[model samples]
Target chain A: MRITALAGGVGGARFLRGLRTHLDRSPGLADTELTIIGNTGDDISLFGLRVCPDLDTLLYTLGGGIHEGQGWGRADESHRLLGELAAYGAVPQWFTLGDLDFGTHVVRSQWLGQGLSLSEVTTRLARRWGLPDQRITLLPMSDSPVETHVVVEDEDGQRAIHFQEWWVRYQASIPAQRFQAVGMDRATAAPGVLDAIRGADVVLLPPSNPVVSIGIILGVPGVRDALRGTTAPVVGVSPLIGGMPVRGHADACLAAIGVESTAAAVAGLYEDFLDGWLVAPEDEASVRLPRATVRSRPLLMTDTDAAADIAGAALDLARELAA
Target chain B: MRITALAGGVGGARFLRGLRTHLDRSPGLADTELTIIGNTGDDISLFGLRVCPDLDTLLYTLGGGIHEGQGWGRADESHRLLGELAAYGAVPQWFTLGDLDFGTHVVRSQWLGQGLSLSEVTTRLARRWGLPDQRITLLPMSDSPVETHVVVEDEDGQRAIHFQEWWVRYQASIPAQRFQAVGMDRATAAPGVLDAIRGADVVLLPPSNPVVSIGIILGVPGVRDALRGTTAPVVGVSPLIGGMPVRGHADACLAAIGVESTAAAVAGLYEDFLDGWLVAPEDEASVRLPRATVRSRPLLMTDTDAAADIAGAALDLARELAA
Candidate 1:
């Protein structure tokens, strides 16, 4: 079986990791080829080094190197590099990059500077994480630099800042007027991105931020079209639980797009192609859809086993729809 | 009073740091402005980030962050970043950069990418190291990217490799045919480099590598002329003791250029402009010069205090020459 999933940072990475765990334990499913299309809209250049937050998160989480407590970055991390950068008074001190994590950015920047596309650089990075050995192929949504910029109004007046500045620095407290994928128009889907979706047995959207993660991937020129055109059943696990995000600022993100913070509203965003929707038990009654089957399950993903069960439920729903 | 010095990496940084210490304790000399023109030919792009071995050595030493045991790099440094890079199979893993040291390259690369000249970047780095507060100005020999490439014949056949690969990786064991300053033809002296040389009350040469360090600096346009035209007496501390260097592969570097590893031979390279030459007592007998004063002293910088005394002796010689 082939599974293609669109993922963001922590939440998406966690869900996909759980999906991998589920596949590994299930008989006959161990050979499944999983192609993850990671959101690159969160990509930022810090200290002239390219940082792909979502892709790195997936790499770390899946490779067993993740800071489990924080749910992103590397385990056994040190901040000495960051401490030195701070002492030098280099700007944007808010987004903390560990010494180990810096290794990724430095090599990625080096490879990219050497004229390799993001896909090529990411492939090299993934190889280091043993992603290929696990039958995982993680590709950025697009090779073109697509950064999500958040438009926010504050005492300083209206301004557009990189999504990370708003998300990591300001904690998204600053009301975002809207989100902008700065280079989406020029971005073409990374090689295999469209094919992964079009050729997959099942397509899953993890519990990633709707506005900046999956939504940003959807904005990639041919991505949404592929989803609508693909014959595979498209399943989505709701990022929200009882009108609030399980993680991150999905509610605030939905508000910026004028969408209600509800499972039904999120499903509505993908109504054209969505085949099945997985929601929290509390949100089951309110998330009814005419074209898609809505299923209720405990979506908290409190642990890896819980996450595996949730992911398995989503896959089951997709399989039922396909049948 | 204005004092300028030419420098390389470890030896130069140690001597200059000692010079600063000596100046601080000497009455009336405490206020003297010291300008250091550091060699940049040793600069290399590692992992696609600018790595200035000599300049960083100067900064870390003068800033009180140097690894005392190694006489270069940051104290209490961790190799976590380098470890990660190695895991990713990034090339040129021979020259290791510590986590704390990476902070310097990252910011410098970022600033350079933003179109800041190397001199400007060095100034900012110096500020963080409190060089400005100590009235110390560290200038790269030239703003242009001049790299020293060593031509060596090995089992791989004759090829020109980066100076660092020869020096650090091979430990200069591979006999060098000759040394080439790859971009020196188009290199101009960085701003203030010529001024520092010509306008100083005293000019001193630290016991750095003669062929690769001080020699490369002299290759910059107008620098040799400025040294010759300067009203200030030019004094040099011999890098060799009894025809042998105390540290580093200076003899091998000298051999590459067909120059004998002797104090007198080294002074001959500066014969046109040298005013005073400081050599070890054993080498004093052989280093007689017609135009330049020869002074004998213990050339070994065994510790900080010894380095200070040696630097102070060089200054005294310059003062005597001026008088």
Candidate 2:
């Protein structure tokens, strides 16, 4: 069976790892072919180096080279390059880009500079991580640039900054007035995105930021249409549990747009395409879905085993909906 | 007194280190201002990063961060980026560019991409190393591209390869027919090259590769004219000892032009502008000069002490010629 997953950076990758583990541990899912459409809205070019933070996180995590504690970047990484860059007084100093990570940036930036589309460059980079053997395909949501920009009110007035600066530099502390994924009006989905959705046996949304991760993907032209029109069940695992995010600044991002950081509100936001919803057991009583099949599960992914169990529950819900 | 020096990479850097030490140790020379005209023939673009090998060696060495044993690059440097770059199958595997060294390249490439000349970018980088405190100003031989290409007879036929490929990859084993500094014809001296020569009290050429290093510098339009027309006494130290180069593939490079690796032969190559020559004590008897004052010293830079002594002797010779 072919499974399509939409992912962001660390949290999404963690969930996907669990799903892959669950498939391996379970029988019938052995031949499952997984194709992940990753969010590229967070991608940016700094110092002429193309840095795809979300896409790189997926590559490093799945390839078993991720900084396990941080869930992003390479393990045993050094910031020598970044330190030296700062010494030169290069701007945008808050981002902690590692030396090993710079290697990926250098290669990707070189390819992109040579005129390769973000999607094409991403697919080529995944090959280095042994993606074929893992039966996992990672692709950017679109070939064109769709950078997310956040509008905030400073002392002067209201202004916009790239999402990276807002998220990394400010720690999302300032309330964002609005979030906009620039260039979404003209950009269609990447080459295989619609095809993967149309051909999938099931579509799973991991526990990633709904505002920027899956939300940005859905903003692309025809992406929501494809998701809503696909015959397969579209299941979502809420990133929020017990009125807060599992990890990341998702709560802050959600609050920027005035959405309560609750599992039920998250499910409500995806009510159009979501056919099945997996909420945490603690918040089961609070969820009020009009039509989707809602299931309660222990959603604390404290360990691999817990993550696998949560993933198992979500898959079971999707299977029931499909039947 | 104002002193100007011509230099290359490792050997040139070693000589400069010695010269800087000699200036520091000698009485009444503490206030001497030094300017180094570095060869840019070995500069290459790897993975789209502008790497000026000769200028970098001078920066790292004079700035006290050079790999003391190797006489080039940074000490305690890591190749994590280089290793990962190779894993991605990036080419030009022969050169071992360390991670710290890559920082310099990245900064330089970015600056060059921003429309800064190679000379301007170099001066900005030197600021980070406290060049002013060292009483040193380093400039490229030419702001325009002046890459040396080596013509060699391959199995297919005679073809020109980059000087780096000829020197590093082939190890200079293939007999070179000739050397060409591509784009040297249209290239003029860098901003201060001629001024440094005209303004100098003494000019010294360190023991560097005569053909590719000093020869390429002189190939730039107006550089040779500056050397010959300058009122300052010009002196050179033989890289060749009795009948062989002390280091590098200089002997192989000189052989390409049919010049014997002897003290008198090297001096004859520079006979036009040379006013004094410094050779090894062992090679003093064989030295034959038509016009320049010839002197002998222990030319092997076995240590800083030995190198300082040689530098001192060369400066003394230049002073005598001036008188």
Candidate 3:
């Protein structure tokens, strides 16, 4: 079976890690291909280099080079560069660029300046990291620049800030009015992005932020339309469990969009295209999902083995819907 | 009094350290304005980021932040970035970029891309380093890119190689034919370069590589002419003492240029413009200067104090000529 997964950052990376593990162990799932369409809204220009945080997370996680503890960047990282940049009074100083990770951005920036598309540049970077051929194909949502900004009201009144500054710098301390994906109105889906969804036997949306992660992908022209028209079953795993985010500030983002931080609310956002929904057993009693067949299970992926179990359960649900 | 100094890498840096120390203590030299025109012939672009060896040497040395033992870069530099870049098979693996130093290059490369001249960029970078307010001005020979290449005869016949590859990569093991400043024919001196010479009370050349370092500076259009016409006395300290170069591949470059490595031979190269020459006592017997007055002294600056003594002696010679 050819499976296409729509993913964001940490949560999506964890789910993909589990899915890969399950596929590797299943004897009957031979010749299965995984294509991951990653969100690029969190991309930023840092220290005069282009840094795609979400894409790097996915690449490092799948290529077996991610930091096991932080769940992002490269393992065995150093902060010598970060310290120097700080000394120079670089703005938006909260996010750390580990020494090992800066090399990736350096190469990407150089290649991008040389007239290569983000997708082509990503392929070259993945090849350098020793990613397996045909096992996983990573694609960015668009080649053009798209940034996620947060409009917030603090003691100084209302203003818009880059997603990184709002998320990493402020630690989501202020009240957010709304989340905006700047430049998405005119943005076209990257080459092969729509085709990946159209050709897949099943589509999986991992447990990533609904408003900024998956919602940003849906905001691109014709992407949500593509999902609605696809014949394959589209499944979404809830990022929220027990009224809180699994990790990071997903609740803050949900609040920005005026949506309650509940599995039911998240499911409603994707109900038009989703055919199956997976939620935690705790939230199964109160959740009201439309049209989509809802399934309750242990949604937490505490380890690689546990994550594979969750991925296997999601795949089984998709298979039952197809039958 | 205005003082002009010509410098190269580590050895010249050490001499300037002494020169600064001496000037700080001298009663009459408290208001002396020092102008250091660093050699840019050793500059190269690695992975699309400019790496300026000589200018960085001067910056770190005068800024009091250079590694004491290594004589270049930050004191607590780390190479995590270079190791990662190597894993990606980046070419020209000889020169390493410390993580801290990489930030400097990224800023410089960004400014250069935005149409800033090298002189303007250097001024900005110096300000970030917390340099004294106009205590010293560092200028590149020209804002235009000019690289010194070494013509070497290997088993594959003669080929012109970049100066860094010749010195750092090959360690100057092969026989070289000539040293050529590739873009000097059409290059103009950077703004303020000619004015610095004309306004100076004395011009002193430190013991830098005569062929590649000081030679490339003179190769720029109007620079040599300015030196010849300046009312200020121009004096040069020998990079060679007792028929041998003090440090680096100066001897190899001298061989390539068909000049025997000796104090008198180096003096002959500067005879048309220079008014005085400083040599070590050991080479006093062989010294034969035509236009410049020659003086023999203990020319080796073993420490900061020793470097100041050498600078004092050079200034005394200039003052005597003025009297």
Q: Which candidate number would show the highest lDDT if scored against the true structure?
A: 1
Candidate 2 wrongly placed segments (more than 4 Å):
none
The reply for model 1, stretches above 4 Å from the true place, is none
The DockQ of predicted model 2 stands at 0.67
Cα lDDT for residue B112, candidate 1: 96
What tens digits encode model 2's per-residue C-alpha lDDT throughout A35-109?
999999999978768789999999998888899888888999998888777777676778888889999999887
Q: Candidate 1 chain A, which ten residues in sequence have the lowest lDDT sum?
A: A83-92
lDDT of 3 by residue, A30-97 (tens): 46889889999999988678999999999998888899788898898888777767766655568888
Candidate closer to the true structure by TM-score (higher is better), 1 or 2: 1
Candidate 1 backbone collisions, by pair: none
Q: Model 1, A96-178: lDDT tens per residue?
A: 99999999999999999999999999999899999999999999999999999999999999999999999999999999999
Show the colliding residue pairs in model 3.
none
Pick by lDDT: 2 or 3, better one: 2
- What proportion of true contacts does candidate 1 retain? 0.91
- Give the TM-score between model 2's chain B and the true chain B: 0.98
Best by TM-score: 1
Top candidate, metric DockQ? 1
Cα error, residue B88 of model 3, in Å, equals: 1.8
